[model samples]
Target: MQPDDVRRTDVSTSPPDVKRPTRRRALVAAAVAAAVLLPAGAAVGYAYTGEVPRGVTVLGVDLGGLDRAAAGEALRAELARRSADLAAPVTVRVEDRTARVDPSAVGLAVDVDATVAAAADARPGVFARLFGSPTVDPVVAVDQGRLDAALRAAVGDVGQPVVAPAITYDGTTPRPVYPESGRVLDPATAAGALRAGWPDAREVTVPLLDVHPATTTADVDRLLAELARPAVSGPVTVTTDRGDLPVPPAAIAKSLVFAADDSGRIEPRVDEKALRSALGTGLREVEVAPKDATVVLDGGKPKVVPGTDGQRLDTAALGRDLLAVLPRTADRRVAGTLTAARPAMTDEQAAALGIRERVSTFTTNFTGGLSAPRSNNIVTIARDVDGTIVQPGETFSLNGHTGERSYAQGYKDAPVIMDGKLVPGVGGGTSQFTTTLFNATYYAGLEDVEHKPHSYWFSRYPPVIESTIFYPNLDFKFRNDTPYGVLIDTSWTSDSITVSIWSTKIYDSVKTEWGPRRNITKPRVVHLEPGPSCIATNGIDGFTQDAWRIFRKDGKELKREKFSWRYDAEPRFVCGG
Candidate 1:
């Protein structure tokens, strides 16, 4: 126990303490080795088992230590439960309205197999597995087309469309209807947000965007102030060589067309057709037509008359200039461009017409008891057709010259032959003028283009050779076939009308040959008149006749023209039977 004895004992005890620590170290090493080996053995066993590691979870569903098949079953069940929960309708707010949509209806689904596989893959390495497996969310699958359609349908219910600006015209002014802004839910963005956070969030707000109108109030105001109002403010005066054509404000307003341009700007345009129509009679009055030279017989010789040059207003150029000046407040007058027009026949052409002394003349005598109105009508028709000139190759229409013989042209009711009966009608005596004119043209060797014989053969007219005319429907037409200008000269007294053709003679002589009437039929007995308007008259027998016109030069037969007519029988009428 003293210093030497205490030192020897402490040495022995220290050696014992060192040996004890070595044994303790050996025990600690063995414990650490066992800890590593157990987990390694468990990992090896797990690898051989073909099963998911313990504590693995997918979307909060545990599938610990399960084989692939069992894991898949568990995953399917969990996915079904989760999907059903997510199938709850989520409320979507668009503007002030709300709509509910089931996430599954929009093709939202949980990819259970993929999610399970991902969770299985998240299992840590052998060392980390000793701690725990990771928890992973389920993979979500979405059908974009279905989701887009659903979102659009929902948006359509709540969206307010934008109103476009429009223009309306009053009698004198133009007014603008203003545009309005609108709100619409953005379908694509709203669908994306819903897909990302749906089910978890019970409510979602739809993204809204403003829709602006293409045309605004300012645009309408600009159009009215700059284009529409100025176009119709004042008259546009077009000064031509003839006279001034003042287009009134109302006419300009009617001609002005307002339309939108490619850039969507409203502008004014002049409608050429409308402007021409508005000009109408005014334009025709200002038009100066070229006058052709005429030929006349001067003492049995041909005489040439000179033609006059014509000045015509260029209407197209005037329209353009008028449009240019329409926007101006002052100096609104524009001079129209004049175009020169040459006549078809000149003085040389007139001399070449070959007009000379009278070629043929015919006179028709009417009964002296003809009413004053009938005599006046015959004289009036003769006067109207007196100075008519037919150029070579030109056809003359008697109805075209005389027009409709009615009260408007001072014609009076007179006796006329109509429908195989004599009746009192307007322009009754003009047929006498037609018969005289046809005979003169026939003897003059003119070509007959169109002519109609009277329905009933009249003794007063040449048998089967005379022509009759009605207003516009029926006409007596003949062509001036000779290379000459033929002048129609008409003269009439109280009971006789004469028509003479003055032109260069092409034939030596012309003669008419009449045949006896054949196939005659007896007239029918007349019935009583229906009213006082009916006139009693004696009937005539119906018959057929043939006639011919023979033209000869130097006594040799040149040509012979034959004509035939079949007249219907007339019935006798008793007025007071």
Candidate 2:
């Protein structure tokens, strides 16, 4: 009935770690217990008294005798109270921005009943039974409500459902966000985060492309409308390749649309205005069809070669048209010019020609001296018959283009030019033809790309004056000087071998006049053993000459250039003494 008795019982039953109650409260509680206990036996009295059971107290509130329902109700109220107490918006900082959200946003709930239930599991033991009344055990369930509140407070606002805004990534360089599940966040994820972080966000339509062949803007608009509703409660249809795809309205509304940009980049977004605008534009019509363009090879309609019946040149035309299409002068347009230019040769001419009608040529193998005291222009004229043209970017191969020299190709055995002396030979006197072509190219201002010098001296071909042709190794090559293609024209007579270069020229006139051989330097002497058959000729010694050419335009000299030539004397020997 007294404080001393209450103290004796409490001390015996109280947990060692638990602090004793305040003296005033302890005394009053003891008195109340005695008043009720004196009438009934101590056990019955305490049971009926409904006094504060021995257990842990939370904020001075005892919750010992309550049943499960009552305890649960009480716990719920406490959780609600705690939630309200912490209702003040929590300010969370991420990056450079701060966000505010209520603690309840993170799902915090409190249950006093659970704590009581746990406490009931921890009943007073033998010590309490021996010395004092049995004490109620106190257990605490994790304050899920409070914990959630704190977590939400820390996390800021997360709008919609727990899994509301899902992120879709275009697989581009998207901003990074870490998901709780340790996955990478895509654009859709970023959108979801934005929704969770921002409250004033309005509904926006995200335009998405259909994977199917056909889809209408109205269908997409309807889907958007359904998503824009207050709370998406049911499934909705979204267009797909297979057919309409039924998806949650909430998912659709907050869903990010993936659309390809001009660069084929998938962009995830949810802009209703932009979405509607895009859908209105409709699908892009197929642009250019796949087909082969006609290009003429050589000129005229390319003749189907004997072996190439079903095949034709890849291009529409060749020669002039080809030259026009190739990289050309600054002012000329390749495509336009090629379309307008006519084929270089007629169809009949091409069919008659062995190779197409562009140019026919053959090489000469001359073994004797040019202008051999016995050899003359007749042999030279007869050997000259082939012609050629230098297309842009083409390299001139004298022997390859001219072809081999043989009896089968109309070549006859005659005096030919070789190392300075005349002799009975085949394909002789071809140098005149080569020299003539060389002069033409030189006068035409074309590039003298490759040329071989004669092995012996020649009055006709002073150094820088002659071009030699050998079956494969020796050659004379020149590039066309004008933007317009150059055509080689060859004609032969008993007295002359003429090789003319015909092409369009920008220059009104190209004239060549020899400049005085100036800066005369002494020639270097050369000595060598002579062969037994070699004949020593008088007055033949090594000489050096630097000659100048004055190129004239109309009448006036436009440029003056020098050409250097070095000659070594031939050694003489007696064949028969």
Candidate 3:
């Protein structure tokens, strides 16, 4: 044979799989070159030249043999749904409970650019590209810790709380309440499931496990058989020093009660008030009334008044006897006793408290300026503050004593400070009463806990020392710093309201000193249309000032405290907009 014929025979004997791929590529290259040369085949040549490697796919959408731009467009179009779903928050369910979680908050995201680039990078040999189908997993970023936290929050309270055993009275009979089981969710497993399923799904349901309570049905059964059943079985005769008292089954049911602790153990407690009430008028005849000592204002000074003590049934002794005799089916007789009872406030305790004289008094004159509604609000607040007694070491809260002053609470519409102008608002003109009370507390040498000065200076109030109050937010509070009890006495007329603090005088007198103003700023004028909502104001200049409180004893200064404030300018508002 010739050399050329021998070489051709050798090539033909090679494997068909390897030989076929090489031949096919050569033929395609020849066809591409031919198509480029021909005038009408240029478009087809352009299409085949820039195509990606065959058999490449991303997320199940086929992108094999397509150009780079087309591949990217198709990839983005197919993944648009998952991308949007990833941005939206997902809801997680566990039994009846459900909560929402944001994928971004949990550090979960789909990397589209990276995924497309990866698909572009796939370049295999011709045979493999033709015969094999390759899949590119999309790029997904996940933070394990953040994902766990989000899933944990989303699965909050996934289980029901265990119910403990208890007992209740059914009119004259005792009934038992059995314990119940519950379920709990597994957060770690839920997070793992979400990481795999999210973006593809908007809702995930986690599995739950059973949980048991500390107290069981057996405990309820034991309690019912041992204590509850026999206690209300028969009548119990209670004997006081005077005579015998009858407690029937219904009364015993009212008196007996059981409480369960955290450890699920039942403890019996006596309702002394309920037992006395259930005794049915027999106890009233045997018991005597006791009086409490009180302080009264006689003439102009406060005086300690004496009180009396009386005889009453011993509650502790009665409880012990009743509990012992309850379990017996026969001879249910309990012996109780009458003992001497003391008043809540003894004469010695009342005498120890020093409330003898008028320590300080302040009166704000509203004589000519206040309207009828304002006067009514002032008098109403004054009546609420009257007869109030402040014990030693107690903090008095003005807001706590008087709740939100609304129309339903008997306050009327009047002028109030708002936006640097006087507007008609409900519960207006109450600030005058607040300022009066503040001055009274100040002169009494009490500790000011909290107080806010007016935004602009008012000529009617003492500069830098008075206060303004609004409901819920702004409040006037003071601590009674003295060892003596304080008696707050308020009196009002049509024109003025006076608040007086009465106690044994510790300081001779308290006085205030003003400081010169600084940082003065001029006010601006503004005009608005005249309407019911419009409020006109004569603007005041802004300034910073200080005040000093001087405490005196025996005509000499004891101590002094400094208070400072900064005021804002009140703009001149012309109601003609």
Candidate 4:
């Protein structure tokens, strides 16, 4: 082998005698050169070219700059200049109201400049550094963008402000604002507004009320006119018994007034006028009435009086008697009663009973007889005509038994006291009748339940046994003490009065047990001489006695007690002709 051949072999074996390009080596060489060249080129572009990425937008404003950072800074400055005036408070008007708010309070901010600076300071990795600059800043959008949008929307809708006018309570008339309380609304502005906005489902009405002067008759007339009648939608008239009178629905409504003022409250003013007109037009009316009592003889059998144009009522006489009784009639009803139903009596029967002889009687004035309070008349006749029966444990009331007496009944005036003076009045002597009956009842062993004393002492009657009565307040009462029923019979004569009892005989006989008249306190007596013009009178001493009687049945001891009798101690006046 020659030297050349040997050398070639050595070179082939000696790991590449001549240089060969490799994949890794080529890549490194190219990258180093590009790195050096790209920087230089970028430097040149930045110095001369104003080119920027196509999509580069800052704050929604498109721009061209040396790089993303520079563009961002420029955008921030522009935004700051545009929004500088919005940092302060802004005023908005709505109706009559005004409101002010700081723009910053509504999510507005001046931090854009600082945010841009931070973005400019951020750098990418080494590879991206070699290529191109990173995006200027992560798309900086307004913070709380949605919130700001909402605030802006609200501000856009703000309207003009409103001013309320002042109110006053004038003195025209102090009246309730809500006259119809039920349908009335609150007078407050807010409440009124709400109510006006939505009326109630039901029918509503408001009544107007005001006060007026009531001093003049004219005022009263006006009030009456106002109260005339109410215009009622329903039936218009009603009837009453005082003859046919008219009624209007409106009038009924007028009867009740709303809250009255100084003058008076008038209700349903319109309705009242309408009702009055309707009433004046003459509606048919039915007569309202009361029960009419008819007097009858013997179970309602009436006998007609012969004359007087069928006007059965004795008006003239009744009026005078009523006038006399009126004063005492206060709080009391005028009443009388027949003892019982009576069968008609023929003349023969009346004679047999001696009624004519028994009833013809009169009493003298107080000078010669009992005083006014102790006088009696009606009860006596009642007992005599028809006996009264009182049962065991029964109380007899004079007023309860008697009924009202008017011109319709058979009542005639006797005599009575008027203003403390004697006058002709009906039922004047009735108490005398009651007194006689009372004495008979006492003798019959009945209990004296209630009795009133005379205002003045009377010397002509039995001091211990006499009784008197007025209508309701003053009454004579007694109870039947006996086990059986007792009947009373009374009779009268020109000179004397008698009362008898008819009943089952409770005892064989009743006798008074007399006490000795001892320790007599003699009273002074006087006598006067007779004169031509005046009659002379002698006075006697008064006397009092205590006595008792025993009741026996078949000789058996039944009851025993004391009885008393008293005469006025002053004396009795005896007159002589």
Candidate 5:
């Protein structure tokens, strides 16, 4: 390409807006395109096959007097050496934080073939080869979009995100979550800085931009005063059809929540479900209760109460009503409208349970140690569960009802079996009470949720069917699977304890058929010297047995289930101490 001489145009003759292109500038732009766009290996191959003018240098390597093959070989060796250096990670820095990212991972490459073709573009005439030395630009390939993403990950999220203002209710008090300013590293600028430093720079410091949150401290303070503080200032009265449902400040606090709007201003929202849960048993007094169809013991006879739907305060609209009155300082009251409510147990479901008679009655007589502390413990736990009511489909838990029996609760230490030996334990002999209750529930054909028999066989209780309980750990539980409500009644004397279960009888009777004992193992005899802890015992042999339960309704077999258990051999306690 021919060069154009520089000539300054006269301002008087030419228009200011009109600018002309130079011939030398155009040729230089075309030469750059030839070098940069040498994207094909065939072009590199063709360039290497050609003789280069002397005084040419690529990356400070003189190809000045080299042949076609020699020039290509030298260029490849130099590029390979640079590639090894590029294998090290490119260090990135943002303030004090520094990270090392792999060159290939960030889509950076030497592009050897393209660079080789580009280096072949440097040419000099005979006179210039003797006097002038020129340098060829290396083609460093970079994927801009990929580099931006890689740099963003290498530098941590630029900085922290802005914390928006919000409010939360902590019991009866209102609390505020304040907003804060943060910093951000612009992706495009960071990527440019990284590219300029990579494979050559020791480290690059990324520029940071300060950011401010949409919500300010003033906004949070305004919300706390206007909405949060007043919401839980005092109790709110909601008038129902029957009486007033008083919602305390604690409940009001639970219902109040804060959220940000489109303009980032904090706003209040009432949660109806949360409000109902916070209200708890208070709703039962003011709201008209729905009567479920159930059988109850009336005048010592089974009686059915027909199901009836009742009208209660409309919980769906309670939030709206509460929201209107929450911010008021005086007379924070709202009139709640009534809505129809349905019973969980309908009349048809109660009738199907067949709980119209005394289902099961059990009596167990306690001998030996009748006047001991064990008897007192038994009576104490028994009285706690007396007249207990088990609703339909409800699982009655003995441990849950009577709670942990301790000396504070009037329980005394007594001899109890633990680790195959008789040891003194609190709330002892309650296992007898457990056995009695288990028998009653078993005869009633109730659903037994959990039960565990004794480690050793005892003549006092039935085999493979008795239950033992230890305060909080071991428990006897039974579910009233029938629709009829179960009434647990207990009575205890000095020598006898009796448990009777009353419910509408679904089955005429539930009977257990015994199975012959097998795999009998004799007990090991051991003697303890005379001491206060010494207790004598005549241990029974261990055995495995299976018993079948026969359920009969209207004198016909309804269903049959099998029960299996393995009893460990009880050690003979020959106390000589």
Candidate 6:
């Protein structure tokens, strides 16, 4: 072969001088540039993309490759289809009763916006953009209030109210009523289960919760066993400083009270008011009232009687002690303290009452038949009116001082003037005492507040200067107008009654002037049936008279007072006619 032919064959056989390293370097640089450029391009595309990544699903509905608005529309369309499934009423079973509930009425709704957002969030990363995204569940919202309301309405008619335990006492025995349990739907739990299974399952079982009563039968039983039985087991004896009072078991039982405390426990106690009432009458015997000092006439001179201190049981403290001891087994005893009560008027105060000398004296005579009853009545009145002190600025009432002269007060029936006629009545001779007291007050220059005259004129009493008094209806009142206190002293004999006023003399002298009788009225005779109650007396003519009282100091007239009296005619009554 020739040299050129050999050279060509060598060149073909020597791999033609190929640059493999350079080719490999160029391929590697091209691959690196493609990795960076592709990722950067994808990032820019993702930043500007308005569509959701691929393979995203909401409630099993595909929402991929769609814009936000388009995704929301797709989710809403899928939810609307699912809502058709929810249109079928779900059957709710509670215990033995069953109710059909509409999901829409209970505020069951789909959140399309949230579902779309969840789908968007499930988008694949840039590297994973070539792959599928993860499956996501849509967010569902429910109105809890509306759901609970619908559930309550479904079970309202079938539910029973819970009964609370109670205890009632019937005199000697205590009865207890047991509590009853009630069933109600648990709104939260039942709603969660219902919402999770809604638009899919045709029926759902509602969870039932138990309602417990505040009190139970065990509580009542515990009260009866621990408190009531022990309280009524035996009698309680309450002993004070004076004596012991035995209260029977029945009474103690009535006083026992079983009440609930703040911790819901029944506690035993004694009824305070009932126990106090039971001991009221017994406590009265242990009480002593205070007596004020009195002013009395001793040998025609004012003397002070010393006041006395009183003692009374401390009922409140005794009640507390009794409550403490009453719960014991038997023979319970309690002692009460005696509190001292001071008298209103002390001996020194009584001595300071200015009653030094006799200011005035007056006497009235009764010349008629002085029967034993009439004499007894007069003596009784004099005894009552004697030793009564009239303080300064105080008014003395004859009727108030001398109470009603009934047979209960040891007064005998005698002749008394009534309806212009003398009739048989109790306290017949009291009018004479009134007249004497009035005249004594008049002569003493004391002020007279109120007084009434006799119905007819009488020769025994002064014409217009006398006064008469009956029971509560007619009263003789006089005010002590002096700066010093005045005391009344009364005495009576068989024929006359005397009333004297004792005080510091304020006036020098007192004189009275009388006017002649005028407007005379004749008496009329009347016949009456004879009986034991009939009374026969002489009648008198009626007239009007005027009198004046003149008070003098140091022989000079201080003041002059005028008084007028009008009398009615008294007709004579003839018995056995």
* Global lDDT of each candidate: 0.76, 0.43, 0.79, 0.42, 0.78, 0.76
Q: What C-alpha lDDT, on a 0 to 100 scale, does residue 239 get in candidate 4?
A: 23
**Number of colliding residue pairs in model 4:** 33
Cα lDDT tens digits for candidate 3, 226-300? 778888889888777677777788878887876566555666666788887887677776777787776777787
Q: Model 5 clash pairs?
A: 354-504, 355-504, 356-504, 529-577, 530-576, 530-577, 531-577
Question: Local error of candidate 1 at 457, Å?
Answer: 2.0
- Which digits, one per residue and each the tens of the lDDT, describe model 6 over residues 532-555? 777875778888989999999988
Q: Which order, best to worst by TM-score?
A: 1, 6, 5, 3, 2, 4
- Model 4, 395-459: lDDT tens digits are 98876676532224444555443433234555666556566666666666667788654432355
Q: Model 2, which residues run further than 4 Å from truth?
A: 1-387, 412-426, 508-541, 554-560, 571-575
Stretches of candidate 1 exceeding 4 Å from the true structure: 1-229, 239-244, 253-277, 280-292, 296-305, 309-312, 336-345, 368-371, 530-532
- Residue-level lDDT tens digits of model 5 in 434-501: 99999999999998898899988898888998989876778899999987778787887779899989
Among these predictions, the greatest lDDT belongs to: 3
- Per-residue error (Å), model 2, residue 425: 5.4
In terms of TM-score, the best-performing candidate is: 1
Look at candidate 5 and tell me the lDDT of residue 409. 91
Error of 1 at 303 (Å): 4.2
TM-scores for the candidates:
0.56, 0.32, 0.52, 0.31, 0.53, 0.54
Q: Candidate 4, which ten residues in sequence have the lowest lDDT sum?
A: 160-169
Please write out the lDDT profile of model 2 over residues 513-552, one tens digit for every residue: 4434433333233332455333334324445555554555
Compute the lDDT of residue 168 as modeled in candidate 3: 84
